[model samples]
Target: MKHALNNPYITRNFNPNNWMSDIPIIDSLSLAELVLPGAHNAGVDKKASYTALGISHWAACQNNSFYYQLTHGARALDLRLEYAVGGDGVGTFWFQHNGFRSSRSLESLIMSVIRFLDENPDEFIILDFHQLNPGNQRFDYKEFNRLLLTHLGNRLIPSTHVFLTLGQLKQASHARRVMVAAENHTELDSTYFCEYIEHEWSGIGTASVSELNVHITKVMKFPPGGSLPWSLSATSYNVAEGPVNIREHLDRWFDPALSDWVLNSNIINADFFETSNLVRHCRTANLIKANNH
Candidate 1:
């Protein structure tokens, strides 16, 4: 006798109800709403240029996006990669680890992250890998992460996409579905690959850009979609607050190549962080820190 089996939770075709707490943009925004490319604003309109101004990504290592924008001309991509290489970065990938009980497998971590992402879809997620000590047992999680990334090209809605800043992913490659990578300048590796974009980031919230430190990064956006994101969750806040020493911690994003290019990029847009309500971003970043390891 045999029985049929399905994935425990009954995977669907990524129904919004499965993960999205907010209404889908298809329901919220009309096709006409996000249109771009007026007659006057011209650089070089290639066919691949994303004409629609849709989808926004937020992260620490933002300068990566700045570089990408210079090379690639796409309108729909909005990248916010934050380079927070300020952790012990010990073991193997503390720069992206979740500190997961100090003794968990990558599978467990992936499951935890998946569940977390599913449960809280509104919040911008940072799957912090600054604490992982990958070994024989935990290598599965790393592989699973790549698998999930590959699937996202097919899975993500026009509204839902993952934002990432990789302190270390050895050889990452993904499907062409990836729209933007707001990461630092690096050789396109097998492990970490995305259509990089350029964004002007003040490099704030890092160890060097804290209140205690003179350096400051400004918010180009706030509270994620103008409301306190429900999915950004408690754990997300924990990670934002975990770093004790800001300056020493900033050393992680301290790539000489990245810093040099950032100093010479044309990604300066002051409008994103110029609102009175911008304090919400700090609140949110701190909250994310508080919730993570």
Candidate 2:
């Protein structure tokens, strides 16, 4: 009598502990070849008193803390910040979503990430510091670099060389690597602060998911190897709608079209990533690509 073959999908239970651990097959592939799940406005998890009504419409993009975001398989983080200075000449940083200030400080967020990376050695992260809100004074890129280095320490992957693959990063002396990309630090010597890879972000003007789908579809079409390592914003925000609940929107529309978006973009970023199992979808896309290769 012939015995039945075992199916890995049936035998291996889907582990929620770390979705990144599930995609070991793509470890040897270039970062450009993998599809990473990302969070848009990753820092704004809470609302502040000074947060304006219009800004509040899209303010709390994420509902959980930074640590939670990592655990849920978000590899890329979009951070917008403003330099905060005390009367004593000491300076700190605060997260900004549009013009509204986040209740949590930037240092707090960085510390949380450092602690997470220390525990999870095999995992790597991409930190995109995009927007800066300088009130009256000029934004200090040098000071920001100092703070980033102090917190990140040796965990940062030097911009001097490109990290081609996940396995390359895992085998390095410092297993936990973070690629930092900032908008202001343009000079080549600023290794820790580099520019972002191509990212196509759709405007948050669509009031309904149907309207938003059109924008998403248009952005997904790209020439072969056009925008390798590119990010696509899959979430939607309408200032006129007032306080758009991300969780509700994801369940209603984004979740349905997620698989197609994942196939098209290297990074598919959304609001409240944990809600609709967006990370798992991205992982599946990577798995499919690896199998085909």
RMSD of each: 20.6, 4.8
lDDT of 2 by residue, 206-237 (tens): 53566666777687566125423567767666
Model 1 residue 281 distance off true place after TM-score fit, in angstroms: 4.0
Q: Ten-residue segment with the worst summed lDDT in candidate 2?
A: 1-10
Best-matching candidate per lDDT: 2
- Candidate 1 error regions (>4 Å): 1-101, 121-192, 195-212, 217-242, 245-293
The residue-level lDDT of candidate 1 at 93 comes to 19
Instruction: State the TM-score for model 2.
Output: 0.83
| lDDT per model vs. reference | 0.24, 0.65
Instruction: Please write out the lDDT profile of model 1 over residues 1-293, one tens digit for every residue.
Output: 11122322222333221221122221222111211101101111121122133211111211122213222221222211112222564232111212111122233323433443344433222221211233323433334345446544332222222232111110122212222232332332324333232222333333323332222222212322311111110001113443222223222222122232111111222112211111222222222222331
Clashes of each: 56, 0
Clashes of 2: 0
Q: Relative to the unseen true structure, what is the C-alpha lDDT of residue 112 in candidate 1, on a scale of 0 to 100?
A: 37
TM-score for all models, in order of appearance: 0.26, 0.83
